[model samples]
Target chain A: MKEKIHIIKIGGSLIDDTELLDQFLDQFSGIKGKKILVHGGGKLATTLADKLGIEQKMVNGRRITDKDTLDIVSMVYAGSINKNIVAKLQQKKCKAIGFSGADANLIKAKKREHAEIDFGFVGDIEKKSINKKLISKLMKLELVPVFSAITHDKKGNLFNTNADTIASVIAQALSAKYDVELLYCFDKEGVLEDVDNPQSLIKTISEEEFSNLKNEGKLHKGILPKLENALSAVKNNVNKVFLIKETQLKNHIENHHEGTEIC
Target chain B: MKEKIHIIKIGGSLIDDTELLDQFLDQFSGIKGKKILVHGGGKLATTLADKLGIEQKMVNGRRITDKDTLDIVSMVYAGSINKNIVAKLQQKKCKAIGFSGADANLIKAKKREHAEIDFGFVGDIEKKSINKKLISKLMKLELVPVFSAITHDKKGNLFNTNADTIASVIAQALSAKYDVELLYCFDKEGVLEDVDNPQSLIKTISEEEFSNLKNEGKLHKGILPKLENALSAVKNNVNKVFLIKETQLKNHIENHHEGTEIC
Candidate 1:
């Protein structure tokens, strides 16, 4: 039997709230066994960009990561947010180390190619991109790696990668050596039948169901990418995958069914 | 005999110039054997702070790192500068990994305890503060560790640390396991007798000579802390210490005497 390792990803909303982040980390630190954290950039980057008067570049209504935006995201995600989370986890007695994908070449990415739109600095990654050997070695040393949504091409460029996809690919890569459980922690109570109703939770989501819901326009714009990433993880042989509430981490870890599991 | 390692420190001015920094990193990559790089925050932090209208807090001519300033430095130094350097080094085929003190609790620190002034997030570290064992393990993996001048209190706060002091203490800590040569690479041709003449470079300076130079008030203000840190490393068990020109890195490594040695 392989060792169990939980790969939990948190979105930006929780990180922007200091008190909530601390509480979440407190619970995260209490989890037993091996774990890795992946975090998204919060509103801080957008806020800083706005303050600096760096206009958001959009092509076909899709957000584009220009040089200035990439710089802002790199600083916010890989620097401020990543270090702060590591510090807080350290205080909770978790052996957390922070990283961008460029660190030790943990993850190498390629610039996203498009038909008509240039995504600027956006990167696309696959399971092969992850340096799983070194990651396992780090885990063997009992170190919890906290990763930021920043990746690099070996050709001297840092790109803005999606945090959800980062978590998924890492899980896919590491599943070869560990019993990897990937969790996507968000603001809601799993996939909701009604976005506002906590009681209307979907206990499990399959790829067909997800596609149907997405096609029916029942899913919100934000949860679309997350569910896609989650499905990708399940398809890639990740042991288990879930979409859970940020506040339900402890409960989910204990009862093993607090949120919607992806099958 | 212990295995050899070169611990090099670079200043902010070098980092501020992109072209010069790339050239220096190229030279750095050409060097043989185990090595580590510690870099200072360049003008970007101050530039960002100024743009954001965050006033520089000073007391008795010493800068204070308040909440706002700390946030900016953490973002610029640990995020933008460190990752960019790592990416560039990777491009040069150097296996570089970037870090802050908080990463893996690599260097735990204490808040600066001053009698009259509050330095806010400034942290002070010692020889014992370095996690040398883990660092050695990292070196064994053939990864070059690149550090940013950002540390944490372990109690949940990231602090602005002096990059020179960080290099000195790390060298001191690792000297027990490696034959360490600590180098401070900057713009000038080592310590100069006449600030304007590169030919006026002092070949070496002992403690007595350094004190005499200080008493004569001949040394410039900026080099004072750097010289002090270099001396401290020599006084500790660091095998050797030098202040060399940034451009002379390759020459110094080859010829082994291009800088002003500290005895």
Candidate 2:
């Protein structure tokens, strides 16, 4: 059987948790497979911007990346966040290469302009142009490719992309014979049915049910996009989509516990 | 008198020196002026890439930014390095806002394919479309702009730019009635008379002498580019250029330092 391809999306919240992040890294170091790690640094970016007195403006929870905001986001996401993960993985003896979308033209994208609201510096992946060959080369050498959601265009202009979405796209693109699993690892257990209750973890949710919950206002904003991204991955040929707590990796991988499993 | 505009380029080498970085931040915190900071992260970027077993190749000392390398560079320069500086400044009570080229469309550039060598993702300033208004607004709020040398195109694509060059460009652009002082801060005392001798700091050098030294092979690679950038700023109306040791900030500002003062 071909090596199992797992694309894990680690959110900024979980990445910032030193204890949890170290634990995840330890578990990841022992794992033997072709793995791709995509990460987000939203909290870090926003907090730094706020502390610097740079106004934080978001359109629908997503940062409205003007030139100034893009600068801050790039620094936080690609610089601090990416390196921290690489360093942690290295400490665990994992051969991991951290990168942004512009590297090797790994993920080419077009800046999405929606009506009057232009998502400045935001990129939608040029799915066909993604150089999966780069990932394949690295994976063959047993190296984990850690990616930040920053891409470039044909002309070599960079764009800030959504990490979860990028992971899904990458998983789909790299889908060969092995089952493609996308793990959206965040701080919480999984997609919670109640925002205030930690015990209200949804064990499983179908696409229809997820949409219904979203419409009914039961699904919170944080997990809604994650769910949509997970569904998109499933539709795009990923075998399974898992939303699990980052710290519960062993439980989820070995015992399959305490998270929403999406198909 | 209008607060003198100072453009300071803090290099990765100095940042690596913890003591120097801390000292510079403390000094910068007390400075009263409209200041813009441009930073380089070559050392950190290369270190991380090497640890990951990624063979780093450079064209003219600048990293040959392929897709993967660009990602690494973005992460190191914009993400990790940027935040560390901002955090340190914040710790010192300096209101510092970190930014990359994509923010506020502040710096726009065209990819230079000079002499058939495709300098992958490297950009030259567009000159016309720099978002001075956005910078002006930020300065009005007394927020010191810490810039990463990344640029965007008219179509919202990001590119890696030379921090020294970007600093020069920004200095010229932000110049009003007061002369813009461009200071390239690094670990070295200044441009040396002899590369082998640390004590041979050149106190002053004319444009012609600087060029002569380059031709004579006394100046090579990285420093050449930095000098070129400094000269470009001088030619473009920036008032002065100083190659000063980051640790000697107080002496340099007080006009008593042993640094290479270029005019």
- Please report the candidate that would top DockQ against the real structure: 1
Cα error, residue A60 of model 2, in Å, equals: 7.9
Separately for all candidates shown, the number of backbone clashes (residues 3 or more apart, or on different chains) is: 0, 26
> Candidate 2: lDDT over CA atoms?
0.74
What lDDT tens digits, residue by residue, belong to model 1 across residues B65-89? 9999999999999999999999999
Model 2 ranges with Cα > 4 A deviation: A58-62, B1-263
Over the stretch A202-239, how does candidate 1's per-residue lDDT look in tens digits?
99999999989988999988898999999999999999
lDDT of 2 by residue, A30-79 (tens): 76667778988757777656655678677776667787677667666777
- How far residue B55's Cα lies from its native spot in candidate 2, in Å, is 34
- Tell me the alpha-carbon RMSD of every candidate: 0.7, 17.9
Give one digit per residue, the lDDT tens place, for model 2 in B69-139. 66667666777666557656655656566666654456767877778567787788844546676677657
